[model samples]
Target chain A: MIKQISKPPLAIDDSAVDATLVKRVQGGDVRALGDLYARYSVMVQKAVVRTMPRISDADREDLVHDVFLSLLKLVNKFDRARVFRPWLYGVAIKKTQNFRRKRSVRALLLRQRATNSEDNPVHPPADGQLENAEIMEKGLSSLPAGQKDVLILHAVEGFKGEEIAEILEIEINTVWSRLHRARKTMLQLLENEREEPGGHENGV
Target chain B: MVCKYLYKYLDGRLDWEDRRLFEDHLAHCPACLQQTSDWQQILTVAASLDNKDVGARVAPPSSLDVQRFETMARKRIEHLGRLSFLGRPLAVAIAAAVLLGIAIGVWKNEAPDTPHVAAPAAVSSRVAPHKSDTSGAPSQSLSEAPLVSPSATDVHFDTKVKELTGSETLHASAHNGQCAHMGPDTLCLFPKSRAEVMVSDKAHVVALQSGSAVFYVQPNETREFRVTTPLGTVVVVGTRFSVTVTPEHMLQVVVKKGTVRVEGDNEAAMVQKGAVARIVSEKSGIVTRLATWDELAAFSVLSKMIEEVPAKPLHLKSAKKPVVHDAHQLQDTAQAQSLKMLDTWRKEMIAGDVDGAIEGLLRYLQAHPNDVDARFLLATCHKRKGHPKEALALYQQLAQHQTLSVANRAAYLAGDVCIKQLSNPQCALQYFTPFLDHSGRDAPQRGEALYYKAEALLQLGQKKEATQILESVVHTFGRTGIGQRARNRLREIQP
Candidate 1:
């Protein structure tokens, strides 16, 4: 007979662990909240950082803080029997959306101000600096705001298109349409870049 | 039932019967298989990019922090309570004063029987001649309150128009201090007003606040009407046009029509009626010239067709293929057989036999280990069976293969298993990184891989590094799904 290695104590069954933590938290055991946070923060932080690329480290930390604060406010509303990870993730996703909307508004205002200043024409980034990544970012940012939101939720956040629709309060078909258009636009832009002499490093 | 099942299947939230049916569909439908491949790729990319640190780092706000917040909240609440006690009488007094002012204003309007109130009522009544013509039954509720006083009602209507129509559309009509939603499709059809109309599949009606009203029509179907705008889009069944109001607010007409005319903005250019012209800057005036085919394609309606059936195999029966080489024939034969096998599996899955589908795929894979499609399907089947370890192993094997395309698919699957099932972002990064190196044109998988790689990095507590990768994804494939995700992620990370 083969001997099996003993499972570690911390290797509690996921379902059981979540149920216990939820029960404790609901019972006003503050430490349970900390435990849950410790368990899920790494994933949430990773998700937030990956979603908000242009945001600085300091800003990322602040957003992470905001997510936690929001989560606390929502702990009481959680369904104890259900897994907390998805619910927590949903909160993180919402916070990220709010941050992006605010950033977009700020960027628009800044652009308007700069345009009015007349000090210098807003020149496009120099050719050399337009890396594949930068080109991709510009193309994405140029998309309609709604399209950008749906595409990001479905593609980056790892949410199903249906999940995205639910979160964004739109139809799933809309998400699909936005994603399709976004891809087509990106392809067109990339192809255009490739056509220019010495424009893109990876020529077609 | 079909939509529900598809949703559940895609979400991996399906039970046994549904899962079996989904697998059968996968086995039989080549088109569905291709779509499945695409969806798998997307999921893989997303998993690779997901923050690994999410579960590990998420801690509820500390007791001390919560206490501090609660204390502050308590103090604020107490302060508000006290303020309310003193504010009641003062608020009542202020309310009485406002009511008196309103009463005076109403008395003034009553004395003159002001033509202002009558003007709106009469104009609305005229615009909607057939009150009983509920032909297009207004889906949205229209407030019945009179718009006589400069009261909240008028303000509310103005705000509603601004919200429903865009700022650009309302600018002209709002300036004339008049804004209204006309017929069902016509939100604000102000005649003789200079309006900027944005016409596309997405429609909007803008009412300009300027003396000259601008009308923007994003017309869906063919409808002819004269619209006055400093800049407007005159759309035909198969054409697009633009009219703009310059900084000087002068109307500039740019015709992007399949067949239309440029009458006002400047010199009348009797375009073939299907050409594009631009009202140049305020200094230059209207430049109504013919547009190129590329420009025409831009305004061409973008319609997507969703097929219920899978994509059929391309029949290779061309005149040039009369005598094919043995090797080429063998390859074609193999492709045909693979397609048939896929179809069989889909039928089985649809019949609600997930295991049978998997068994068939497994047997097929044994003979064709190099078959990326088969391998991917098999891995997915295993995943559906709740066997993440086996699925992960197969995905890993495929990810390490020589072909970049095949490897990318495998890498994506591996990443999906790691992040979604195994909950291991560290493991997912290992799979995602190789795909990112060569994620280029034929491999949209690369954009996806880079996205996942960023997620894995973040999970590992490499915040700065992850942010850099995400930024790169946004910059390189910004318009693509992966790029959008990166941009969204960047926003979430902001302070």
Candidate 2:
């Protein structure tokens, strides 16, 4: 494993690094695959969590590797004119979507809730935060699929309207409309939870 | 009353008139104003998934997860890569072209990548001047050919050292664009140039297989230093010289100091200091002349190489070996320093304090689980402490290590313990398989892997498999000490 050492701050563009690594990977350079994984894994993992909140840890881990494996075979289709991060995230989202669609009903029903909270690097949903996290998961899952995607890409991933538009491959106006409706529905869900008699909700 | 423009306004998408209407409504409508605050709060909670102010709700993949993903992904790529490369129509055509090229070379009575050693007496006479015999050199044109290893056995160091078989280099990198150090020899490579260096008891060999490199070899009487190009070999006792493979793939040797025997085809040229030797196949024989300014410019990096060995270590060893202390006791004051404590623990091990060493090693591994050397030492401590199972487990973990030598060593040690300590030959086979799987034919542990695998096979009542493996050991590595042992075993088994 290449330990990421703390180094002198250099103004290196990430896009250039990604482009170089992608080209090298397309040429069958394995180290570049490792490098490309190292750079974007954290972002992809976060996206995985937001995309598939209920995915079993083992399944999630497999899903993550599957995304990269798909990239290894499919990256040739990535346009040089497009940015790599959005392209890679697009791959991750599609893999997750496919994983969701293909997994058996019995498997979904038997999905194990993670017991090793200590091992989880994610901030555990605790106290009032637990309700919000649950609500976020429930609310997002309940939304129209397109609206849910736009909301997650905008609010959770912190992508701009333009980047989300490019990633979702939709018009910028469609992204805004979806994001608007998604946020409104989610806000209504949270407000109803807050107003339900027991009202000492944690402020934003 | 619900305001339709509230969310759009938050998104910075509302037009000027719409923004006015939204603010105009919010000015009097407390319900809409409070609703906007609620939306802001909810979005804050949502954004907290990514925001660092509140701990990020979604953690990225852990380092271990990243490692697993990398390993699995690389395996998939490798599997597909092999299939794709072989599956290509172009691959077949290229292979045929290469075969045809080799056939033509053989038809023309030329040997490629084979340098004949010159006896000292005939070294001068046998090498006819410019118009003479050039026998061993490859007659095929290398003008468009990519530089590759001469062969598996006599392979040179290239940038792809990670996957390359054998212990070829101590350290290799294009440091500051030119010079790279391999032990005492400093190789200053021309930009984008390639070379391979191997140091062993018998020979210090370098294949300047492509581009050019200025080699400064410090003289050692015990070993012969030989540099090979695709076209020829330059044997020197001690020398500062530059070897270049030109665009036409001709061998150009410029010697700045000492004498070098340059051999190409069947001809040899004894190039002295300040001389240049050119070997353009047997037809051109060997030409000697004064070095040009450009040929001498290759030595400019020699001044860069003049710096002393670094006074301080630039980085800590990733796998630090425990240092044994002879007399001094480990102080409690220094116990807080885990790595130093590791040294004291090592001293304790040497002093037969097995429990103390185990205790310290366990603690050390708890802190630095990835340190394979420390883990190996801990395994040794465990084995000495008579816990074969514990030691075996640690060695099994160590076998997965990325360092080729360490992985091979771990597998070999694990197999030995399984057979000798635990008397489990089947388990021994399990451990030995990794050594064989990862080791290339030229890999240092390839012989040991085979030898141990054969031993396990024999113990498992698979004499046929054992015999075949033993025969392979004899056939593939018959020159080595392991081969001799394998041959002796074969004799006992057959007779």
Candidate 3:
């Protein structure tokens, strides 16, 4: 037999720890919920900030709290066979979507439905950020809803096509197409803004 | 310039061979290379956007917020309660019962030895009248009490805070004197009083801005009832008391039923029951003394402010504008100004203006004859003015007609007049018997009632029974002045 070089056993599986914590949470141990919050609060908060960049600090913090509350209330409904991180990540995304949906309704009520990102009065870009990032943020707001979701999941969340497909419950091909459309639209909008300032307000 | 596999390659849907083909195509096509470079910049933007400190854009973390979250989650879990064996209808019923049980438990824990003492604000006239215990049954002792809160007449604290986090700081102010029953007891504010009252799991604090406030604090081991003033602070572990800031910059703390510590000007003193503490200018330190008759008379009605719960629902006849139909708010605030009348009378009584105060009460009683507290205060002023017949008449009427606490007090006062003023020992026995045979430890004036009962017994020539009762008072309250007087009485009778 070939010489078997023994390597240290692989690092402990995080899922096992998560499973134990989840079991404790299901058994109504709120301390376990606290533990889960301590572990993943920063991650959930990061996802919220990235998704809603112009969100006020209070709104983002409340959104993070809402995500954890949903997890605390619905931990029993979680499928144990799956990984906890992505499931929580999925929870984070869904809650953010729900929040955005409500925010959109409020915006509509105020008659501030802005088709152009730069013209949007409800969420203005704050001072002191990368110039290119601000332009990208404006351009991203102009993209179609489906393409924007897929693009954020792929590029920002660092999920591959298959994972994005799983998280968003879309076909792999659909994820590819939407992201392609998102890039094309973003690039065109950025170019128009550079060439002619007010010409991009009409939207793609 | 547009390549078919460009997005597939960008989104990682392309195989290695296809990626190789795409790279080959990119190498050949200058237009596609520019397009790919532009797309890469967007990807870079997305990559750098991940976890940017963004701290400036968000609120900082707070431990209090975390605690509130934990409390809210606990309440949510209470909502998501479990039921396995019971059927659906029974489960619903059981769940409702469980919620009610939790509410009652919270009520009992907050109000340990106290009974429901008054009626709700809306219908006190129809409700409280029927509850007057005119039946001649002997009052049961506290140990044997069922520990039941008479639910029908009282506004349950649990229901008031069911929709809230139950830890909010209530900011209450009154241009005129206003009385409100919060939690287990009532807080009555003197005219022009302003206070921030916060009763929470963490602490019970009343930050007094101006005027005087009386607190009948529920006994709690975890937190002290603190009244902070500009001159000094009065701290009570758990008791009923009052705090006033004098215009001369002296802080007066009067303790009716508990010990309080007064702190100011780098001086502090512990004030016990039936005493007062004066926090004067820095040089005098804090002086503790037995409450004078005037101070006691002024603050005594405040401790009994709990009886004011249904005294009036507060209709401000002073409202300048007409009704808006849903003038519930108007009603609540309207009656707050009316309490200024009582405050005026109270000030007059303290200043030895008994006739003026009695006239004010007579006027107020004409419009609202059923007001128990005003009527009782009127009787007290009559006694102070040496009108024993008038005081006795009012006290007997209130004893037979008023609610539990005021009625108990009336009976005790009636007994006092018979012994000290009228010297009618037989009349004293009728009034003193009800107060003496009381089972509950919450019975007010128990020591004095017992002492006077002994005096009445001796007057009737029951010397042996009188001696035994006097001995018991000396044994129980030896540290108090009443106990010293009982010892003196005991010695004179035995020899």
The local distance difference test score of each candidate is: 0.45, 0.56, 0.55
True contacts kept of each: 0.06, 0.21, 0.17
Give the number of the best model, judged by DockQ.
2
Q: Identify the runs in model 2 with alpha carbons over 4 angstroms from their true place.
A: A1-13, A49-51, A105-145, A183-204, B1-40, B48-68, B83-495
Residues forming the 10-long window of minimal summed lDDT in candidate 1 chain A: A3-12
Q: What local lDDT does model 3 show for residue B397?
A: 93
What TM-score does prediction 2 earn?
Answer: 0.31
- Weakest 10 consecutive residues, lDDT, candidate 2 chain B? B95-104
Candidate with top lDDT is 2
Docking class of 2: incorrect
Full candidate order by lDDT, most accurate first: 2, 3, 1
The segments of candidate 1 whose C-alpha lies over 4 angstroms from its true place after superposition are A1-19, A50-54, A79-83, A93-145, A155-157, A160-166, A169-204, B1-16, B42-495
Please state the Cα-based DockQ of model 3 relative to the true two-chain complex: 0.06
Output the lDDT of residue B482, model 2: 59
lDDT of 3 at B159: 14
lDDT of 2 by residue, B458-489 (tens): 88989999999999999998976557667767
